[model samples]
Target: MWISLVYLCLYWAFFLLLGLLLVVFLAYCAYVKYIHMKYDHIPGPPRDSFILGHSSFVVKASDNYKVMHDLFLRWAEEYGPVYRTNFLHHVLLTCTSPDSIKEYLMSPTCPKDPYAYNRLFYLFGKRFLGKGLLTNPDHNQWYKQRRIMDPAFSHKYLMEMIGVFNERAEQLMEQLAEKADGKQQVSLHAAINRVTLDVITKVAFGLELGLVEGNKTAFPNAISLVLKGMIDYMKNPFMEYMPKHWSFIRQVQESADLLRKTGRKCIMQRKQAMLNGEELPKDILTKILQCAEQENGLDDEIMLDNFITFFIAGQETTANQLSFTVMELTRQPEITRRLRAELDEVIGFKRDISFDDIANLTYMTQVLKESLRIYPPAPGTSRYIKDDDVIEGIRIPGGVSVNLNTYIMGRMDKFFPDPFKFDPERFHPSAPKPYYCYFPFALGPRSCLGQVFSQLEAKVVLGKLLQRFEFELVPGQSYEIMDTGTLRPRDGVVCTLRPRETASQ
Candidate 1:
């Protein structure tokens, strides 16, 4: 009789536990359904499955991220300017309309999504760009840092750096001259990347990384490997915990450590020099140290974060922009001819390009603008919404991601008619400037601080290249855009070059 009572009690307990689980599962399903129905009014591609959502389709389309941006273009065509795509529980709203973009980006109500920016703060179990101006989500903190750094990027300061720009750009011309024999194919992208890296290191930290002089450094390859890991991490969300990827992960972490250690060493040496009562040049490093001393609660690690941040941001985007511009110029000889005509009128065999000359080369300026429109180095920006809002008659609930993509909008027919055509005239100073439809440097307060700095470097480099060499794109290479954190020509813009006089004949 005792055994029978025990078995009966156990049976009742099992059923009660099972019943509780069923109730919980039902409640979860109801919540998910509510969320789905809330976004149903916003148009998007059909969800493949409840679990994977549209990510499976996007993942299938991606090839080294060559097709990912294109997929966004296609979807934008199918579902107006605004649409929502989901990856499991994460829903991202893509806004392409000018008004929508202006409201989402320019407004103070929406803040940067920590999901995307925070990922840049750490990679492969190591910290990078920790609370730097670019990745810092706190508006107040970022504004403080920005105010301190503004003087460094002012017109007066940048004008003083033109000599450094000319010196570094000339180094590139020397390297390319060796391969300008008309038969040897050159990867302009790789060559330009080295020169730009050298420029940023010298101009910012006052360190001479002689990458352009053929002095090999592990820093370049190390930075590249770290960036490559971004794509890998995104592809396999479970990579950090997976044992198979441990080796690669370690390599990336080591590279990040090398960067931080190098930054720390350089910073300490400079600080010591200052303590010794030695006069120092008013370069970026000097400015950073001065800011550190003056600001309260700012730590050394945060200063180092800005160190790496400037190195990467100052170099990568500008290099990619120059590469894509070269690729387009090769295909559009008519445009190239027009640019050359302007270069001759303004530069006229002048090897040293001055700031005043850069401003005078109006046609060259337009070409750069058009290239950026087609292949924006940083393709898009995202924001996290905190309060429910209405945009273009659609209700956007709080706690969702909204992406503003320049690449998608730049290619759209609505904003830019015959968008694929390589026409520099569209950017002529007399022509109407693109409204909110164009924001390559982004919009409002959070826009890139290095905008003028990068563009000046680009114009200087390209003006010299056009003056010295006539480049032709090597056939049988893919012109596809590769998104390895930044968009670059897939084949690195392979081209055979001949001295300008010979090709002109």
Candidate 2:
């Protein structure tokens, strides 16, 4: 009788626990439904399934950045200027119109999404970006850190880094020349990556990556494997979440550890050199050390993170952007001709373009701007609101992620007269609307820190490349934009290069 009573109690307790869990889940679901019911009047994509929400539909079409942006475009057309989707009761609102995007970015009262960065942390944990300006919550700490780092990016200051760029650029040209020794369409993609990585290394720590010096190193292959790991993670959602468990991730992490360890040794060596009266100019590492001295010292952890972040970010964004832009120039001869004509007008054939001349080349600037607009390095930027707010008469709740689809707005007919067409003339100063529809580096407090640096590099490379090889998209090769990391080509930009001067024939 005693045993039977205890068994009954245990059975009832199990059912009771199950019942409570079901109730909580139902309550959560009901709350989500209530939010939808309350805001049902708001325009959004028709929810295919209330449980999964529009993410399912969005994920299905996210083959490319343009496709992901199309989801926003479709919703924008259906739902006024802004729309909302619930992610397990967490709201994600997509702002369709440029005005809405502008309003959100510009408003001082509004806040940047600290929560949205969790995804970034997921991509590259806190150990990589925990110390940098890019990952900082829009706050006073960011301001202080940015102030110290400002000198590093100042145009006057960065000019000293040009020797670094020139050396790497030479290596790149040499590599290409070697690859094209007899006749070969060298994987331009790999060639560009090598150049960019070389630049990042030498500029960041003054590390003479021996590739430039013709020294064979495992750094290239190791870095390639790391990049491949990242690409795989972004493609596979599970790896994105549980990064450490995946075997490839472990390999990449090991490589990253090696890089960080190498960076630390370099820093210490540089410090010793400085102490020994061997003064190096204010390269990035020098500036970072100066900041550390001012702070009395930097935590090694923070330093490592900054080193990794700067190296990865500085190289990845520009290289990807440059590669994609070059591909476009290859395809569009008319556009390419006009760009070259503009370059000729400014720099001429006999001379390498001066830095000052880079600013004056309006048409080339437009080409770059259009390239960024069409193939934004980051297709969309996400931020979660820290507090609930209202913009353009729409209410935004705290903890909701704002997916600002730069790619989508760049193609919005409401913003651009004909968003699909690529026309550099639209960027002219005399044009009726200059910034009315444009924001490539983004707007407001968290805009890209390397904007000027990137533009300078782009102009220099594009100016030089156009002056040499005339390129066109190789027949039967169509590269689709991969929406994953840095807007990469799904296959790769495969093109046949012919001399530009031979175009008249």
Candidate 3:
């Protein structure tokens, strides 16, 4: 009799548990439906699934290896300037309006999207760029670090870097000279990447990486791997737990760890030097240490965070920009001729380009600006909306992710009449400057601190290239952009270089 009673009780308990799960599932469905209804007024592409939202569309496009910005461009054409996209429960508002761009990015109170920035804090379950200026979402904390590091990027300090920039660019030219035989195909992207890496390492940390001289360092490859891992982890959050992905995940983690480890070692050495009464150059490393000291103690991890941040941000975007500029120069001979003429006139045969020469390379400056318009390296940024806002007659609720994309705005027909044309004349001094539409380095107080630094570096490297070599693109190479964290030329900008007949003396 007792056994029968116990069996009956077990049967009732099992049904109750099942009933509770069903109720929870239904409640979740209701919540998703209600959330979707909130942004129903905002125009966007038709949803593929009620629960999944646009995630499947994104994943499918990613799987097909389609450039995401192309999709955004298409949608912008279809849905108008301010539209909404849903990723599961999260609502994203992609804004291309100049007015909205100014309000969202220029406001000091505007906060970075935690969901997006925090993900970058780790790459495949390993600490990467933790609470650094780039990934730090706290406005107050970011301001403190930015203030401490400001002197490192001041005009005086940047002027001091011009010599280092010229030295590195000269090294690159020497390396390219051996491979300048017209028959040999060279990857300008890869070569320029080495130069930028070497420049950042030497100028920022006072370390001579010698990447341009073909030093077999794992740092470059590690950075590439970490970027690839970032994309993978972002596209599929569960990738870290999947057994099939374990090998790549392990590699990404190790690469992240290696970078942090290197940063720790470098920081410790600098600290020791300070203790030994050795005077330190007021470079980025010294500035980083000062930031840590201001925080009441030397926080190696935080200092390392900025170290990795500088290493990646300082090198990658500038390298891609230079590479893209070379690719365009290869394609447009008229533009190339004009640029070479400007380089010849301003800096003819001058191997060491001075700051004054850089200032006077006006036409070269326009060309580089045009390149950034067409192919921005760090394409876009995101902000978290804390309060309700109205943009372009559409009401964006308080809790939304607003995407501000230079790539999208740069290509719009209304903004640029001939959007696809590689015309440097658009950026001529007499031409009207794009209002808020042309933010290759972003805008407002949170704008890129390295803007001047990057452009100066770009000018030095590119001016030397134009003065020394005539390069032709290898046939059948695609000019398509590849999004690997940063947008890069899909074909790696392969070219065959020949010494310019009127090469610099």
Which candidate number would show the highest lDDT if scored against the true structure? Answer: 3
**RMSD, one per candidate, in order:** 3.3, 3.6, 2.3
After superposition, which runs of candidate 3 have C-alpha atoms over 4 Å from their true positions?
1-17, 290-298, 502-505
Worst 10 residues of 3 by lDDT: 291-300
In model 2, how large is the Cα lDDT of residue 353? 53
Compute each candidate's TM-score over C-alphas: 0.93, 0.86, 0.95
Q: Tens-digit lDDT track for model 2 on 1-505?
A: 9999999999999999999999999998899887777555556767877876765776676643434666676776677767887655656787765666776666644455665543344344424445456665556666666666677788887777666665676666655544432245655665666677777787778877766556776676666555555555544546645746667666667777676788789888888887898868667888767876786676666566667667776777777788888877765779888887887888787445566787798888888888888778766666656666675677665656687777777877777778877777777677766443466677777677778877777677667777767565556666577654466665567655655565456
Candidate with the greatest TM-score versus the true structure: 3
* Root-mean-square deviation of candidate 3: 2.3
Regions more than 4 Å wrong, model 2:
1-17, 34-39, 63-67, 107-109, 122-126, 178-183, 211-245, 271-277, 295-299, 349-352, 386-388, 397-399, 433-436, 499-505
Which of the predicted structures, 1 or 3, would earn the higher TM-score when compared with the native?
A: 3
Candidate number that wins on TM-score, 2 or 3: 3
The residue pairs found clashing in candidate 3 are none
Residues 403-469 of candidate 1 have per-residue lDDT tens digits of 8899999999888999998888889889988878888888888888899999999999999999999
> Between 1 and 3, whose lDDT is larger?
3
Q: Distance from true position, residue 246, model 3, in Å?
A: 0.9
